[model samples]
Target: MTDQVMAAIDGSQFSTAVCDAAAWASLALAAPLTFLHVVDNHPQTAEADLSGNIGLGSREHLLEELASLDEKRARLAQEQGRLMLEAAKSRAIENGVAEPGIRQRNGELVETLAELEDDIRLLVIGKRGEAAHKASEHLGSNLERVVRSLHRPILVVPEAFETPRQVLIAFDGSKTTRKGVEMVAKSPLFRGISCHVVMVGAEVADMRSQLDWALMTLNDAGFEAHGEIRAGEVEESLRSYQQEHAIDLLVMGAYGHSRIRHLLVGSTTTGMLRKATVPVLLLR
Candidate 1:
């Protein structure tokens, strides 16, 4: 809805990748970039009421000490957030972002994203955060919430940065992928890249026709358009297509119809993300 790319920064191994992806999205969309760092809210400890309840006892002294420690921890967190933002801004600038905006807020990340949703054209984030930095089998804690909470497109960087050469869009002819088609057709985001639009189960009554219409739409928008109709499992089919075509970026609708079909969790999107070696551009 807005003309800015929002990049969420957590001081994890994936931070640099996120910044690079944000820079890429900003350039592609020809929009400003904003790097956001969230200093998560910490709940109240047993210190505030100590002065009253433990009336001049040793317990009060210990509680007051704990309170001071909590204050120090909060200060350290603020400083760390500032440093992370500075580093992310530097990365973005180095990756061709002209001038990037910085926003450090104190709250939950999802709530912060919800507040800024209306001003975001694209959201860039890491696939995992520090809490899930296993690099083996962990996914970001807030990935699903952020995807479901925000309506704008999200560019998720899994590994290090790679400039996208060819884009593969996994289409199902659903409203979501139709929206993706409209986005590619009307927006500057996929402007100069070749697009391969593929639909699984094209033997269905209207699937082939739908793919044709999508191809026509992309052709009209000046894309080097290619379409494929494959009959196989959705996630595996898409992965094979991307690999066969040597695609660098994977674009698709965020999920299917029901919450049960979410991509971020134990759904088809999960399998795709697990097997995908490239970055994902997810649209809802």
Candidate 2:
């Protein structure tokens, strides 16, 4: 089965952008789109706080009543989740995604993604949650956890949607970045976009050679590719280069620890995500 693009939405302002990005990815890959809204049931919420309000004699009865209440709340929550999913699906359709799938599950986001990892080709989530927005770090730690769990391309969408005509690739001669380069070259995701391959480090001959090799590979793959070398902090060099060239998307490697980091998204760091102004694409 062809993989689908999964967009995680929380019904915040970010949902619209997530849908837009997911729709773009879905169309780009000619794959189906699935909007997932997780009904996160916190452990603390399962039991009602009746101990303080009820006498000991009524405590047992209250516990039974609380159990019933919990059931009712769960039902209501699922209904609300369905509504959120419907709205998300409508947004995806309006954004040009045809017949997008809607999934409302009761579980942790990372665990849920893991369960469906085999079916998802790309994962799209907001760059920031509704409660925070500054740099990529504030996009939420949960967002990082979600990315770390999936061995697929993840599109971290910003506040709005923009067609990515140009992509700036941050390469550091790492194996992960090499994998990212290969993914971009082979995937239909970036077929018609322009790519600027950059290596940020000391202006050593080896650095230049690596950049040239990456550019050659991209060019050989039929991309309008260019190569450059920058000397400075990796993130700052990428920021300046992207700004000067007006890059629409930033494609790099993973973030996080353990096998998840190495297998997906690659050497991309949280600091880089925190500083980015454009959408970031991370491939493992």
Candidate 3:
């Protein structure tokens, strides 16, 4: 089967960043990119029922007005979606990416993204929704649900990131880390790029040997990767490393421990997302 990269675009400025990231990956993998825009079904007004207190004729008029507004909103959303897709396609062509396919699906974001996972090598999404609060660093509810449910790797791009140069891979010998490493090793998108494989945790007896094994795996796959072993909390070490290395992208496994453990101890993935200044590639 042909591999594809699926990018979720909602016509926001952040959606443009998502498209750019997806375009880069598409070129790297020599794969097709599919742009998907989901039309959310949630009603715009929760107070529509309150309008019923008026006279029957007025209420009927209000209902008609709401219906007309909804239609106009849907049409505008589709037009914006088309414009964004066209701009992305033009950029891709300029960057030597093949013609990309675009589609507008009418459904919730999470379900649509999950349903498209079978053929997608990577899913690119914005870090926040269009109307998210400025202070929140977390993904919007729709993106979060997709991240938790989809089985593929997700690349979350913030609003201001332009291009990715240096990449940091958060390593700890877990299955998730291994999977992330494999992706980097096999994908052409990371080829000839400077990559740092970081292992963070308290000092262990076989840390050197573990690092050696990880390095060997990358070397065997023809990736020029350097290893670093740090003694501290995972999140703290990651932040320090990013600043020191000027990392543009952070690649790691999503929440290595069990849900119960994560609830009690918190997760490094969530911590990094909230604190780090770069984009994150999280493998599930």
Model 1 RMSD in Å is: 3.3
The predicted structure with the larger TM-score, 1 or 2, is 1
Tell me the tens digit of each residue's lDDT in model 2 across 1-284: 35899988885677788888899899999999998888766634455566786797698887777777777877887898798889888888888887899988998878998999999989999886554555435657667777767888888887787889999988988788888888888878899999999888788988988888888889889999988888788777888899999999999887545665333333336667776767899877
Runs off by more than 4 Å, candidate 1: 43-56, 133-135, 202-205, 256-266
Tell me how far the alpha carbon of residue 167 in candidate 1 is from the true structure, in angstroms, after superposition: 0.6
Tell me the tens digit of each residue's lDDT in model 1 across 159-206: 688888788988888888888887888877777889999998848659
Q: What total of clashing residue pairs does each candidate reach?
A: 0, 9, 0
> Candidate 1 — which pairs collide?
none
Cα lDDT for residue 51, candidate 3: 57
**Relative to the true structure, how large is the alpha-carbon lDDT of every model?**
0.83, 0.81, 0.78
- Of 2 and 3, the candidate ahead on TM-score is 3
Where is model 3 more than 4 Å wrong at Cα?
47-53, 256-266
Model 2 alpha-carbon drift over 4 Å, by segment: 43-54, 61-69, 130-137, 256-268
Sort by lDDT, best first: 1, 2, 3
Judged by lDDT relative to the true structure, which candidate is superior, 2 or 3?
Answer: 2
Candidate 1 versus the native: TM-score?
0.89
Error of 1 at 202 (Å): 4.7
What order do you get sorting by TM-score, best first?
Answer: 3, 1, 2
For this target, which candidate reaches the highest TM-score against the unseen true structure? 3
